[model samples]
Target chain A: MNLLPTEEQQQIVDMVRGFLAASAPLERLRPDKFGQIGNPDAALWPKMAELGILGLGVPEEGGGLGLSAVEEALTYIEFGRALVSVGVLGATLGAHLAARTMPDIAAAIMAGTSAVGLATPRGAVAGDDGIFSGEFHLIEANEADFIVLLTSDAIALFRREEFTGQSERLSMDSHMRLMRAALESGKPLSWSSVKDGIDHARANLLIAAYATGVAEAALAGAVDYAKVREQFGKPIGSFQAIKHKCADMAIAAEVASCQVSFASVILSKNSDESRFHALASRIVAVDAALKNGATGIQVHGAIGFTAEVEAHLFVKRAHLIDFIGGDQRVQKGQFIGADAVI
Target chain B: MNLDYTAEDEIFRAEAREWLDANIPREVRPPDGPGMREFDLGWQRKQFEGGWAGVSWPVEYGGRGLSLTHQLIWYEEYAKAGGPNAELLFVGCNHAAPTIMARGTEKQKSYHLPKILSGEVAWCQGFSEPNNGSDLGGLKCRAEIVGDELVVNGSKIWTSSAHLADWQELLVRTDPAAPKHKGISWLICDMQTPGIELRPILIMTAPGHHHFNQVFYTDVRIPLSNVVGEVNDGWNVAMSTLGFERGTAGMLENIRYGAVVERLVDMARQRLGASALENDDIGQRLAQLRAEVTAVRAMTYRIASRAAIAPPGSEASLARAFFSQLQQRIRRIALDIIGPDSIELPEDDPWIRPYLRTYSNTIAAGTSEIQRNIIGERVLGLPR
Candidate 1:
């Protein structure tokens, strides 16, 4: 059991971290006031695609990075830490998975000439032929070339231009743009009763990775603030309460990190226990993100809750991830059913 | 990032499994019958004979000297075999043995290690005091040095297995003039030593199951050599013991609880039927529980993998915290499924007793709140 990341994996993480630090620094992101997915600067997407991030999970034959889910998850974690757009993750993962079985479409997505977004919650059914019609707040819906409408029965690929109307931009998270769309009894690329299971697993894995990133970012921010922000003639971090809160955040982030990394490894190895690991990673990651984000805000005090502070961005992203893949209740149900089967 | 067992590790697992299957007698497993002491002793001896005891300890110390990964595999198989809970020998096997390996003198190792491995002796922790539950440094248990002997006069509370244990891995204040944390000493005291009194503290949750005792040491005398480390350096020793205690073994134990929860799921299915599972709400709840169990299992493996590669640090605290809360959640879910029947106290009711027994998990290994504090400070690098 090689539990530690390979040298190659570490290099990948370091490269991504360095890239995100330079290209998507918090300072640069702050002015946009949009979180990771909403409205990225016009220049960022193409650069990211050039860096092979958009193709992080795509197969080699599909003109992509050909990395495993574990690698993809880690890349997204960096995205999360940078508070980069959810659109990137959605587009990348949707394309990568699609490419594994649907080479042509995957090739389109990997080339940055096409983008796909998940338009349905895992396990949620909207209509026949895998045409998901339930409520979905699309992150970067306006920019996508196509939408992978995930329904309970199947996953339908929809061409963005086929729709008559345009998606509206929302203000809740400026970085992540939201849209509303309808699928009119569309034909599925593939249909299977187990699609819900696949979606559930994939969604959990993505959210878990995202949460890990957010929690880590929150820790970094809180730790930095504690060291530099002084109160009563000492660094705020010197105070017991502040220290404890920071410690809790660190613990949560560490736990979530280990869980996410482990789940990624499990997925790569194709372990029978992958489903369990994925679900567990999601559960821990969601809780960690929520707690770390809240504690981060608490440690930052008034400054954290302000719109200008990046702390709120972490909190917002955490909440968004929690709902996007499915809530704790939904994840827990998947966990229970899997447990029963095992 | 591979989780598959290496070929060597797979062979090791098979060998371990075969050994356990051939050696562990069915009649000795816990819950098969009462006598936990006999059951634990028997299992430990069986493992010792099979060269499976102390799988991670050095060979010189009567261990297999295997990699921690192999040890983890052994534990996974052991748990899978429905083996008896090793709670009775936990202190000896997990903490005391490791503490001795880390800080014990040569003589201490030669004498204690073999005995511990052979299951000739059992150990219990004597750290907590009536006044210092969470604040362990403030313990009032005093041990005065006089010549070559130490006169120990103090009391330890919540000493689990004290009644059955043969030795006590203890901490006591040795210097009143020094600060609370700096003045203590760690000593291995024989439970049979004179002036050592073990009063079984019958827990309300587990009637007749004497898992804890209040041991009052009144002028208990022991050779000064009994001290594991330097005088007034007990705090560090105690910390090391506590730290090593929260490792893959603990994770395995927690995951075993998940197995129990899995059994509860099976029971629920058999009793509640497919119709109950068909309901969206019920299906969702089961799915969530299934997911959490999977998560815990994954987290446990992650921890195991980390421990296998390096000395466990804050990550262990994270796992402990997560597992404790998850176990409690599992219990709550089980109770929910059982409904009002959970409250019923029929003598033969398995769910009722386990329901009561579950409360002890979070409390004993360190309270959930303390774990949170540890995670908050040590793992998270928070201010405290």
Candidate 2:
């Protein structure tokens, strides 16, 4: 079995990496520069659409590039590395999923004229009038032109104007814009019936990809710091303690990346073990990101703890990403039940 | 990339599964001792007779000359079939023969390759010295040329199967005045050479485990032609041996871990009942373990895929470190589910010994610390 990516896949990764490195750098992602970071970078959105990232997951007929899940995953890895707000993921997923069922929303997402956010079912509820009520923990909802409510059994879309009460909140990751909102009146743009918790399973797979990206970035930062940071008249990396930690972070990042890629493949294939593999990928990705993030900070010494450094940003992103698409415990329980082999 | 086996690989796998199923001893074999040695030898002989030995070796060398992927398939099938451990023949067939094939003289290759493939001569490595555990380059075992032969002295420790080996792939200091790494030479030493002695180190976990030993070479002499590579250049040859040592074995190890985990799952089901599922924490941990196992296997395949294009060096260190830690994690999870009862298992309980021995996985081959250093310096290009 050949598990390494093909040349084309690698080129896609390289292109995305280059694009993000040049256009959507972490410095641009800082909220201090932008007024309220929850809002999608107005200039970056059109560039993403121009680069075909927004249309990546959408079907060709919907004016999209019609790439596969693996491509989508690769794109998200770059997004995570750049600390792109979850609004991008939310909008892309919403547009892609709505291509056939909700054409208007798909067109808006593809044209970069609208943003979409997703909320889990935990604090969200639908009233008699089909209005979304209750305090919905929305991911980048303030910036979203529409919101997709994902429940255990169904996925429904709603316009942002339907919400009556909304309050913005700070998430662990400064790049994310969390919102608590009450919808007075809402209408479903479209609803897709999910099977056997497949929606969350799939989301977990993408989240895992993002988490792997966070991990790789964190590890690279640490290794870079270890090489240049001097201690006792030598680069800290020359010391076994720091060197091994960097080695461990590298291993974790590589494994996490592999797992995410593998899971994306299985999910695309719609394999019998897709859900289990996806959940497992999420678990590994979460653990690796958190561990590597902490280690990256420690390797950076006191500078890592300061808000100015990128090390702390990754750690915060890892924490927030862990809770997305079902937390570690939730995914684990579902995974074990889904595939009963072990 | 594709994870599906090719038609050829599948056929090979099926053939291997059939051969192993028909031949592997059904009863659980003793872990170690004289009986275990014989058992390992017998298994190797059986594999040779079945035309399955040295599948990765060239056909002219009395091997099947299959691709590395085929070797992986065979290892997976062997582990799945619960094949007996080949501990006694590992150094000969896996490390020594491969190194010999790469660097040995035609005569050395013709002689040692057949014997190793046929399981006629078991081999042990003589690399580590008591003072040079992870610092392998600093080993002080000396061999001075005297006329047409070399007089060898000094000792090698933690040489597994040394007491039972008929030959040894020994690394000795040929020019001590030169740089430490540059002075070494790789030699094929006959275990019965004059003044050669073995003192088995009894492991506390397994009684009569003669697999690990310390070998002393006092005034031992061997012909200069016995050197596998040029004198004083054995460092590169020995590195080649270690690269093989770290890489291939992980495939079978991953499959073995899979089998053990399957059993562990069954055990968890029996002991924890509905709670195994009801307890989200325990259930998730189990799921995570299973996922991690698959990840390690994927990592192995990715690493193995590079064999044709690149010679494995510090790259193998990544797999080595990951697998060692995964082994420990699998055992820890198993014990977590077994809990207090695990401590009170019968003296010969199947799980107890391996769980106890799991600590050695990271320590042996190279400590996790050493592996990380190699990875950081060689793979990551960090300063030494």
Off by over 4 Å in 2: A30-32, A35-42, A61-63, A121-135, A149-158, A161-165, A182-199, A340-342, B206-208, B275-281
Among all windows of 10 consecutive residues in model 1 chain B, the one with the lowest summed lDDT is B25-34
lDDT of 1 by residue, A90-129 (tens): 5665675566578777766666667665565534545644
**For model 2, how does the per-residue alpha-carbon lDDT over B1-384 read when each residue is reduced to its tens digit?**
666777888889999999988998766675766676677777777789999988888999999988888988888888877887666777788788889999999999898899888877788889899999899999899999999899999999998878777899899999989998999999999999999988889765643355579999999999999998899999999887677778775677776787777676677777777456635566667777877887776677777777766767777888789889888878877777878887776876777767777888989878888888889999888899
Query: Candidate 1: deviation at residue A235, Å?
Result: 5.3
> Top model by TM-score, which number?
2
Chain A alone, TM-score per model: 0.87, 0.88
Give the worst 10-residue stretch by lDDT in candidate 1 chain A: A190-199
Model 1 CA lDDT for position A312? 82
Best by DockQ: 2
Report how far off residue B305 is in candidate 2 (Å). Answer: 2.0
lDDT of 2 by residue, A146-223 (tens): 887654334567777665567778876666778766655566676554454344456677788888888889988898
Candidate 2 C-alpha error for residue A31, in Å: 6.0
